[model samples]
Every structure is written in C-alpha cells, then in structure tokens.
Target chain A: MESFSRIPSHIGIIPDGNRRWAQEKGYQKKDGYQHGITPGFQLYEILLQYGIKEATFYGFTKDNNKRAKDQREAFTNACVDAVELLSGRDANLLVIGNTNYPAFPEALKQYANHRVHFGRGLININFLVNYDWEWDLKSLMENKCLASHEISRIDLIIRWGGRHRLSGFLPAQSVYADLYIIDDYWPDFKTSHFLDALRWYQDCDVTLGG
Target chain B: MESFSRIPSHIGIIPDGNRRWAQEKGYQKKDGYQHGITPGFQLYEILLQYGIKEATFYGFTKDNNKRAKDQREAFTNACVDAVELLSGRDANLLVIGNTNYPAFPEALKQYANHRVHFGRGLININFLVNYDWEWDLKSLMENKCLASHEISRIDLIIRWGGRHRLSGFLPAQSVYADLYIIDDYWPDFKTSHFLDALRWYQDCDVTLGG
Candidate 1:
C-alpha cells in the first residue's frame, strides 16, 4: 500500500471535461456523462484505501442546467446514478444543493442536508448537484455560516480537465485548499493521476496564512 | 505594446515569496517587504497601459499577524507603504480589512470602506490588509452580500511564489476567477510575468458554465 507522511483530510473533486472527452471520442456531448460514472467509484476506493477522511464530488452545477435539454437530462441522470452507487458503499453520504430548484435530482433530495450511512461510515462523501456559489452563500444572509456548513474546510481540491478556475466550488470551505489540476478529462481518469496529486500535495506549504 | 483578445477586467494579485526571496538573497525575512513594493507600482502602470479596469492586491492577512513581532511589523509596514505609494496614482483606492481591530494599520484606516480617488480614478485598486475570508463573509449576517461587495467578481487571479492555494483571499469574489501561478518570488517580479499570464488567458474558454 502507498503511504505518505501527510494526507489531506478533506479533498474536493471537480470532475471536468466530459464534453471535450466525448467530442474527442466522436460521441455526442450527452454520452460523456455516463462514461464519467465509473471513475467516481474508482476514486472512492482509492480514497478508502488511502484512509482519506472526507471527500466532496462536484456533480452538475446550477449553471450547467443552461445546456440543451438532452445534455441536462444526461448529466442529471448520471448524478443520481453516482449517488445511488455510493448508497451501497461504506461511507456517510450527504447531497448538498438547492433542492427547491426544479433542476436538482429528486432521488438525491432525501440525502440533502442529511447524512446517511451505508455500511461502516468510514469516510464522508458529499455530492453537490444543482449547486452554485452564490446559492451557497445566500444562506449566510439568514444564517451565520454557509448552507453547506456541514462539510468541513477542504484541505486539497483536485480538478481534472485542465481548467484552473474554481468554477464556483465551495467558496468558504476552500479558503485554504491546495488546488491540484490534472490535464486529463474526468472519463480519462487514471489511478496515477490521483496518486500524483497526493505525492505533489506532500510538499505543499500548508501554512493557513501564517 | 502588448495586447490580448480577452482581458480580465478585474485581476487579483497575491504577491507571495517575499520571505523566501529575502532568505535567498542573504537578507533578513523582513527586508523582503520593501523590495516587493516597486513591483506593485510597475504592475499598476501596466494595468493602465492595458486598460484593465480593476485590481485587488493581497497585502497581508489577519493570520499573518500571528508571525513574530518583527515579521508582523515588517509586512504591516509594507502594506502601509504600498497603499501610500498608490495614493499618488490615478486610481480609486479602497482598503478592505477590519479597521476596528488593533492589528490593522492606523495609517490605512482612512481608506477603509471608502473609495478615495487618488487622481483621475482611471482604475480601481483594492488593497487587502489584515483581511480574513471569514471576516469578509461575516458581513452577510447583517448585509445582503460580502463586505467587499463594491468589488465586482474577479476574472483572473495571479499568484506569485508558486503556491496553488487561495490562502483566504476574497472567497465570494474569487468564486469563478481563473488562477495563474508564477514560480518566481514576488520581489523578483517581472513585467513579462504579467504579460505571460495575460497571453495564456486569451484562449481560456470563458464559458461561465455555459
């Protein structure tokens, strides 16, 4: 088993580039969503093997609903499937998003703001669907903290598909996250990509400001 | 004259690596602050040349005050000096931070929350001194948005010293900002560094999730 002196307790995953990966494969944009599902389980197993405490996966964003109806349905269905797949796993699962919004998956709404254990609850898994940074912060208008306050601060964020923008991840929690970008698309995830990010994270100067 | 097809209207600058640069040059860690000042002005002039509308500079965080007395004083002095230096420039200067706190520089108190037009106010310059992400969000308790709400959403954030973390910069404003990291120390700032980041941003898929 691979080991390291330091491991991020909470890792935020932004699985990007599904459309590009689909285009490159001569497939329609909507077809790429299904291909991205297997990698979710693969990463979960890796995190479990590595003993990572908590992980958050970026499902479709609220803005992503702007896409064509077929593409939106494809991604929404993929998110529901991904969450159901994790429902049978050994983790504490919570789906965070605007449930009132029509775009949010109804199947995942039962898990919203409520953590449910599948088996042993060895790790925490947060799935964000129909999420927006502004919507997350809007809760602060009435509450003292973020709507997604249940999720702890993120130690590291791993983004795939070569984009350097946060694209509206958990803003408050990501204040001190060390971002690791993988050029490969989400569907093209390799075990090596995650291991490389872990290895690179070993050298981060994590002085949360001081 | 260097130009680009797409220019970020508002750019966030995190000038890191001062202490490392100081140590490398056989100078005390505190000595690095003064050297980082000139680069700020040089960048301001470049922004003017490029017609960029707004920029925010990370001076020092509240957590930075936890450093040794000498280092704290050094960075505090640097922030004050940098703000004073900009006082003569043609920009609308607003210093965002907890002015009520004793750790904040008294000299910058006049600039807090109030936009002071230096000359013609051609550009907006926001200098963060003794700032905190939580503190910025705390304003949402009473107000509808961030304490730094006057500053619009950031388009690009350029960080020096090679760190990939936001380190508690304006969280809400940085939600979708593209991050660009420069490996060189802040004191070793080069005009080419800024230009290179702009060149790289030209091809970014500016699709805000669409």
Candidate 2:
C-alpha cells in the first residue's frame, strides 16, 4: 500500500452503481447486495488499519426509496447487514438520517441513529441512511435536535461510480471537500481504488478558498 | 462554439486565481482586478448570446474581506465596476451578499441587493460579493430578514483556477450541481472554456441521488 503523508482525518464515501453493477454482471439486483455488503466491511477494516479517525458512508438516501420496491429492499438489507457487521467490531457507529421515513422502518435498529458502541478501535464510522440534504439543514434552521449528534467537516469525499456530482451527501459539511471520483462500480470496487483515493487526496492543494 | 444538447438553465461561476495570474504575469495584485472585470462583462454577453437565462458569479466572498486592506479595496472596486458595467446592460441584476459589511459599504448603492433591473436581454445576472455560506443560512435560522431575497438552484457550477472544492458557495442550492473545474485563472478565462463547461454539463448523467 502506498503511504500518504497526510491522510484525511474525516473521509466521506458515496457508494453508487451497485444495481448497475448487478445488471452488468447479468444478475438480479437482489443478488447484488452480497457484493456491496462485503467490500464495505473490508473497507472499514482497511480504514481502521490506516488509522483514519472518522468515515461516513452514504448508505441510503430518502430519494433511493423512490426506486422499485425490490431494489429498495435489496439495498436496505445490504446496508443493514454491513452496519451490523461493523457494529459487532470496534469503533463508534453513528447513523444520520430520518428513521421515520415510511420507506425504512428498522435498518439495523439497535445500531442505527445516534447510539455509539464503545469499542476497541479508535475510528468512528457513520452510516448516513435515508439522509436528505435539506432535512439536515432544516433541523439546524429550527434549532431542533440534530439528526446525528456529531458531524465533522469532510476532508476527502470518494464517490464510487462514474458520477461527478455530490448526490446530496452532507452538502454543508462538504463545502471544502476535495472530491475523488472513481469510475469503478461500488460492488466491483477494489481496495486498491480506496488507497488511490487517499493518494489522490494527498496530491490536492487544499487552500480552502484563500 | 460547439453545440450542447443540454444547456443548464442556471449556471454558477466561481472566479478564482486572479491574483495568482497577476503574480505570474509579474504585475501587482491590484492590476489583476482590471483583467478579472473585463471577462465577466464578456461572459455576460456570451451567456446572453448562448440564450442562457440565469448566471451567478462569485465576484467576492466574505473571506476575501480578510485580505490586506489594499488588496480588498482593489478587488471590491473591481467587483463594483463589473456590477456597474453589467447593470447598464438590459438584464436583471441581483447581488447576493451582506451589504452591512465594512468591506462593501456602497457598491452601486441603489441596485446592490435584490433590486431587479429588468432589461431587454433574457439573461439574468447575479454577482455575489461579500457573501458567506454560514451567514446566508444563519438568517433563515434566526428568522431575521435574509441578506438576499432571491436565490436560484444552480445546475452547473464551474470553478476557475483548478480548485475542486465548493469553498462554501450556496451549499444547499448546489446539492446536485455537476461541478466543472478549470485550471485556467479567471482573468485569462476564455469564452471557449465557458462553452466547454456547458458541454461537459450536457454529458453529466444527473440522477439527483436516485
């Protein structure tokens, strides 16, 4: 693995193109959940080994619920499985999203929302499920309870898909995030791609609009 | 100019690296403003010619106010001059920024914020000066009068001078903006570069996080 002189303290991951990958692989979208779930656990281990403190995964957005029922169910089940696997391990798990959204009732309910599991590892893993950009800000606007208790400014945002746009992942928090886009589909993602993203972030000259 | 199958109705331009261009040219920072001012007017004309209706320019940010007094004055003067020049043309001019700031006391006094100058041209131009993302959102939180009355969602956000981060420009509005980055400095920016950005936006498969 290539060494990074400065690894981002907080990194955001947008896992996209899982269903598309399933189609490309000539499998039903329901069968694609297996590929998506395994790599995320592997990534969490990789990130922990790298000693990265904070990482947020854009697991599911409210808009994703608009997809076909079977597709939505498959993605949700995949996300829950990943979260359950991660929660059993060390580190804090924080989920930021509207749990009350009619589409998603209980997604890793025990570990979903703002419950942090005190664990052996030092890294903090946040799973953003059913997250909407406006709703996140709407909470702030009303001086109401924040969806998630703790949120940090993301330093590097890696999107695994061909898309270049943010896709509404913590819009305010990503104000100065250096985005690294990967052409590989989320399900077919390799660990090498993750390392390359870290290396790419190291090459960025982040002046923060000075 | 190359044709685009899909042109963004609303575009946001982040004009960056003007001072760097000046330094590279072995000129004073103050001299850079003169170069930055001209292309903006030219861009407005280009947008009008291209049949683009809405355009916003990051003329100055609240962070820019933190620079040396002379530097701030020079840039502020340049922005005011650009706004004045655009105002004279027949287009709706709306400036999105905090006017009470010490930096920009009187920038086209009567037509500074929210005053629409409905002109013969179909293009609508907005110049953001002394604008800050947090402050803009803070008003909505406090129930106080907003700094700017009108704001539009940006479809394509093009930043000059090779920076990828948004740098706190309309965070909520840019939730799904396809960002286009140019290595060319703002002063040296060309109409061709603008056209390329439009063309690039046309190619982006913006699914809006679905």
Runs with alpha carbons beyond 4 Å of true place in candidate 1: none
Residue B187's lDDT in candidate 1: 94
DockQ of 2: 0.66
Candidate 2 lDDT over residue span A123-158, tens digit each: 888888878877777776566433553788899999
| Per-model DockQ against the true two-chain complex | 0.84, 0.66
Cα error, candidate 2, residue B127 (Å): 1.4
TM-score of each: 0.99, 0.94
Clashing pairs in 2: none
Question: On residues A1-43, what C-alpha lDDT tens digit does candidate 1 reach at each position?
Answer: 7788899999999999998999999999999999999999999
TM-score of candidate 2 versus the correct structure, residues matched by position: 0.94
Question: Which pairs of residues collide in model 1?
Answer: none
